[model samples]
Target: MARRGKKKGRPISGWLVLDKPVGMGSTEAVSKIKWLFQAEKAGHAGTLDPLASGMLPIALGEATKTVPYVQDGAKVYRFTVAWGEERSTDDLEGPVTKSSDQRPAEADVLLLMPKYTGVIMQTPPQFSAIKIAGERAYDLARDGATVDIPAREVEIGRLDLIDHNADRTIFEVECGKGTYVRSLARDMGRDLGCFGHIAELRRIEVEPFTQEDFVTIAELETARFGGQGDERSDSADTVPVDFDAIDALLVDTSAALDCLPQIAISDDAATKIRLGNPVIIRGRDAPVEAEEACATARGKLVAIGAIEQGMFKPKRVFAG
Candidate 1:
């Protein structure tokens, strides 16, 4: 098989849609997968809380450069909010700080959904990875220091009330980057005159990917070792990455740019791009439209570029 990148552990490059299990922090999951693949480098597009489970896109090697694209894409999450008790961390991790017996009627909850849709300001959970003065917010919170996280604007595409009972409600949300479901749940409860916190959370989709593309860690291990009958991950480490399987199980870097405008360039242009030289782009005797686009050569990604005066200037070049 052709090598896709230089090997720190091995020349692996692609994205893995992991159905991240609950209780495993995002960073820990990244490290475990990196160790499993013996990959040179790896990073997740977005962080899923330890209490949250489901689709976590793991980008490997050169694919890491495109993570911002995936992270900024629309995300779909299905979560459960249990009313009556407020937790310090916003989810189940923290101790109960406040409680109430009041619960909103189903109609009241439905009536409140519209207020959350569209653009809104959300305060992220204090027990979060966000940096504050060079240290993690969670670190400070765990150290018993008071941490006050500021609210920021975020866009919500859709919010659906999936199911509900006396003490809890299930909801599904489609939102953009920087939206915090934990904060949403907390605020919703507050608006309803009852305290609340996330009881269960799962990310069903991230833009360019859906639950249909998700793979569990065990399934990944099995695929790597050809999934020998009845064997599990304990024995997976003994087996090496099937170079043949890597291409099948892993998605290419181009998948990350699915939302970007695309412009195909000539081999000569691609060559010049790799050499850090600018080339004029032409589409059917006319200059390519748009200020930014992903440039490709012979169906393979070349670089992300900008157009100015009809010249395509490579901003970030991809190595073969």
Candidate 2:
């Protein structure tokens, strides 16, 4: 029999709310963090474009199982829309596609707010991550292919004007997952008789994470290598980092499951749940029915499952 190779990197697990900087894509950010921590596995809950900056929740090791919960949560963004010219990418990065001399009045912009609020249909930008027949929309656009992307429903919890000027307008929006801020800028521009594109954009909040929870890439680097920045390590393969300090920056894995119903179980029950077995939950106040629930033993998370007929059935178990 052949010997199996051992997995490399530490088995760290948790969520890291990264204050992602501009000019770095979400996948690149995750890869960098994974290298910084030397973790065996890592993934991001949602994608943030290179042009967008702010909260990007990263999951490492066992926490990756809880990604869907965080990804489905609401997002808050503060963006500035540049008026008079629309771009091919719906941002400053692309060539000008349309231009206008008219700028919308403050009253006119405010009047149109009601139309965008609540549930609305939105068409994603051509230069977006949306898949078109197994290919990215942006890929097709880059290949000079004209793809007719269909509009879809998205929820906007709140949309407010933060500041306005003759050439640009700043607005803060709280919207559901899959909502595109660039689309908002483009559509609003067309409606106002002015062409527009995203001049600047920053996401401040994602559900289950507060503004204060995010840590910058610089901060993570400093924590690992002691403020040396790029000169901290002589070699990328043999870089020494402060594991304790870097690990301290990670939030608990259960934090992402905050929205789900939580149930407490005994160690014995937890053992069974971890072994992929259902256990009967006791107590009169215990939940009898829940479509989605989290089970915790003592203080640590055990499994994500559902309660049916007073039994806790484990769907996904976490390693201790």
Candidate 3:
């Protein structure tokens, strides 16, 4: 077996997709994984609430440089919304401050689901990490200070009603990076003339990464000790885990380039772009017909350059 740090005492570099277990905060999980892998550097792409569990991309060493890329990817979640009651935290963990005398009918909820889909404005919960006046908003709220949080525009590509029970409504949501499903549920209750909060939340997917790709913490621990089974076994209980499993969960740092039309640069152009010089890009793939339109579109961390005259010059380079 090739020991991770056997060659030298230095840390190994790669990505790890942790099926973050419930209870541990995102920071805690990163710390444990870093120690287990003996990685010198590590960071998570996004924070998953301690109450929630699922895909968390842990970037190690050089991969940490790509964290920002994955942070912007679309996320999909499966959560349960409990009706007839609202809480300060907007989730089951919060204290209930209000309840309704009337129960919401299934039809009422189904009718209101469409309103949450697509682009919408959502005010984050007061008991959140969002900052206000240079301090965490939740910290202010906990100190008995009332703070008003402004609503921000977020895109919800899809919000589907998956199942419903008497008091719990199950939903699957696909939304942009910053969308808050808990706030969406709270607001949905408001729209329906009732109050509600999130009951159970589980992230089912993170754009390219899905539940199928996740590995439980127990499995990871076992893999670490070589006790649960072979570290590279092919059996269902001992399937080999590879660097790509972690890489697959990461939206390539250059994924934003996919949104734009690309031009295949000549070898000379590629070399000059790698060297860091700006060149006037023309021909197909250059910002030509839709220069303004392309500029307005969301940009990704990409390598851009072109060949002008006989010299290749580099243009803009995004974070990698």
Candidate 4:
């Protein structure tokens, strides 16, 4: 017999769309949520800089297993680029390294915006987490060592100039994973023949999750204690959380798997795949999705074989 008053065990799975406030690191937010829910497993998709704020999806329980799917999703951000100055950290947090006497008009920024769209080679800022020989580049830079990280290719699907004031310009960006908005601001300034840095940044969306689905830290804390009714706040600054909000943001791992061509299998084939075999993929399906499912199956996904003589012959198995 069970104890009458014993609390139920923690929920096995859920996704938290956090409207991260400024001044907290990504990991700190995850830790707080983990404590709040007492969840045994948790992880965030992409990391947001301490100076920035907005939608940060924290996966809990079995949802943590789907993080890679979310991580690979596209991101949208609204940021302010401050003209006439540049910073070491590429944001307001870093020391000013350069300043300009000239301020350009909105048209100048609009003209230069086109150059950033589409595929581009970008050199990440030195003050970044990118590793060089297993040592973080930022670590080396802070120690007064010179680190030259070669430029890599990244795609900027969309870059639009939203508004411009005398000293600051707001822009919206839709970019692939690994696209650094700080670096974009720095390079855009260079192209304009002026120095600049990101003054403010907020993620607007991360693929499936939008601004409408987010819940700020304050709201979350309030809800946890039942201080306020679970009604959605109407503040533009506040993202609402509801059933639809959760459903919209919660992307199943299989959706990512669907990106690849799927290979159907029999019970025997599934068992073989569970046993550990290299099943050759006939076409590109969601690699992360397949990998995730395989990991969930204790390292066995399914048996893959060629369809020959109107029959499926087991060729390779991805298994434990």
Candidate 5:
């Protein structure tokens, strides 16, 4: 469970490309950043486990509107499989459940790749965040319940072997939403007749944001107070808010809507869209035929909408 945030705070808005360090949960990271920025609202686009680290795009204030788009985008991960043992949770966090002395050759591991590639069915690890009847699956598993996670189809764009050794095999995979790399490692070991578990995992990319844009927590704090003189708050626990510095570190909300087709709307149209009304997209602004678009007015994002016979209807409107 995540800690509840304060109801009253500064209404800061924009995207923060965080280079999440290992051993920090995503929920805690959001809370820390929100407090550092003194933001009224904050949320993350994806949940990165504490054991794994890399790009974790945090949304402040109105930027939360774009979270769904980022979640649906493709993701890339690099992980290592430690063979000879399998954990109940499917990762290093879980207790060892099975083991085998047999090891599979690199060629044998490569041969199994095609079977798991493209669209395939996978059962999520028991110790996962997936909810079951309003309760988290991990909680259920910890309580000694047999969490029968169903097998569902997930998209795997690419899965390639980078390095292979007697005890560990390193690999990189590009996949879509709902695809669990832990499940892949577990299944791979089973296929090779040797038990295995994910030894280490790191996310290298998520759509609209990549490792190149990641900013470490220390880096963000440095940027916040680097040139602000000794203007620390009297409380010592609280940091003084610098709007100009915040605006510099944060990116516009439009940055996350890059996947959507862009459509430039008039100021009047933007106003109507904000009121939950449909606006007629101009001849040149809209794409030839797109179901959805990112409508902007003069350079500011207005709303994300659907195009029905050229009529752009607001689906998600941005208030900032």
Candidate 6:
């Protein structure tokens, strides 16, 4: 029998919190990062529209296992809504579908904040990634088909009025998973009797990752090519790629599990976990039961599991 061939590229793993620039899609960003790192696998925590910018946590190789944790985490967005014209996509990228001469006053915007804050049902923009009977909503919208996308519950922890003018208003929001900033602007505008759409959106925080952790594409390129400054070097054809420097940019895979409770296991337990076996969690503070927890030994991630009656049952084991 012929043996299967080995996969190409480095088996590198970890998270790369990127400062994704506007006009680049999330999948494109992940692909670019994967190519730059020459990794065997890659994925992103969440999707950020092409018009949006800021921290986009990308997972490489073994780190891809933690993507769901980051995706379900809370996110914070700062956005500006341009009033007087509602667009098909809920952003400037779409064509105008409705118009209004009325502009919301700053006082009026403030008065409506309470309505948007806390748990609310939101219908996503038509040109969105949401699926309708297995097909993407954006694809259907592009084909000139309109679908009645139902509103779903989402929680907004806080919504503050940052600034406002006759034409636009800026807001900063802290929201849970699945919340749409575009919907917030659209709904707020409709309630205020002013048509509006998202003019700008930036995600500054995604749970454990924040603005400070972000590295731009230029920086990654510079690090890989040994550029003189922070900007990407134009001499890619001449300079050799620095794999070490590029690898340094990765955040540890365990970092994504910061939200979960952790248990320190012994070498024996680590060995058992690596082989897909459960082990007794031995510690005075060992949780008798937990739905989700991470196990570590000798400062390395062993497995992600749950504590059941003092036994750590492995769910997902890490290569490291």
Span of 10 residues, lowest total lDDT, candidate 6: 230-239
Backbone clash pairs for candidate 3 read 256-300, 277-314
Candidate achieving higher lDDT, 3 or 4: 4
Full-model lDDT for every candidate = 0.86, 0.92, 0.69, 0.72, 0.87, 0.90
Tell me how far the alpha carbon of residue 82 in candidate 6 is from the true structure, in angstroms, after superposition.
0.4
Q: lDDT by residue for model 5 over 103-216, one digit each (tens)? A: 989989999999989999999999998888888999999999988778999999999899998999999999999999999999999999998999999998999788777788
Indicate the worst ten consecutive residues by lDDT in candidate 2: 230-239
Residue-by-residue lDDT tens digits, candidate 1, 1-320: 97687445866788988899998999999997787677889999999988899999999888898999999999999999999988989889889999999988899999999999999988888888878899899999999988877888999999999999999999999999989899998899899999899999999999999888888877766656566533436555454535566447777789999887888889988999989898998876545555678888888888987877788888899885
Error of 5 at 134 (Å): 3.7
Please tell me which predicted candidate would have the highest TM-score against the true structure. 2
Ranking by TM-score: 2, 6, 1, 5, 3, 4
TM-score per prediction, in order, is: 0.91, 0.95, 0.75, 0.73, 0.91, 0.94
Pitting candidate 1 against candidate 3, the one with the higher lDDT is 1
lDDT of 3 by residue, 86-174 (tens): 99889988899888866678898889888888888888888888889799988999998888999999999988889887777899999
Off by over 4 Å in 2: 1-7, 231-242
Task: Write model 2 residue lDDT over 1-320, tens digit each, in one string.
Answer: 99989648888999999999999999999999998888999999889989999999999999999999999999999999999999999998999999999998889899988999999999999998889999999999999998899999999999999999899899999999999999999999999999889999999999989898999998888887777774435464463554798899999999999998889889999999889999998876789999989999888999999999999999999997
The predicted structure with the larger lDDT, 2 or 3, is 2
Model 6 misplaced stretches (Cα beyond 4 Å)? 1-7, 228-242
Q: Give the TM-score of candidate 5.
A: 0.91
lDDT score, residue 257, model 3?
A: 35
Using lDDT as the measure, name the better of candidate 2 and candidate 5. 2
Maximum-lDDT candidate? 2
Candidate 2 has a TM-score of 0.95
Tens digits of per-residue lDDT, candidate 6, 1-320, equal 99999647678899999999999999999988887787889999999999999989999999999999999999999999999999999998989999999998899999999999899889988888889999999999999999779999999999998998999999999999989899888998899998899999999999998887889999887877667543334454332444788888888999999999989988888998999999998889889999999999988888999889989999999996
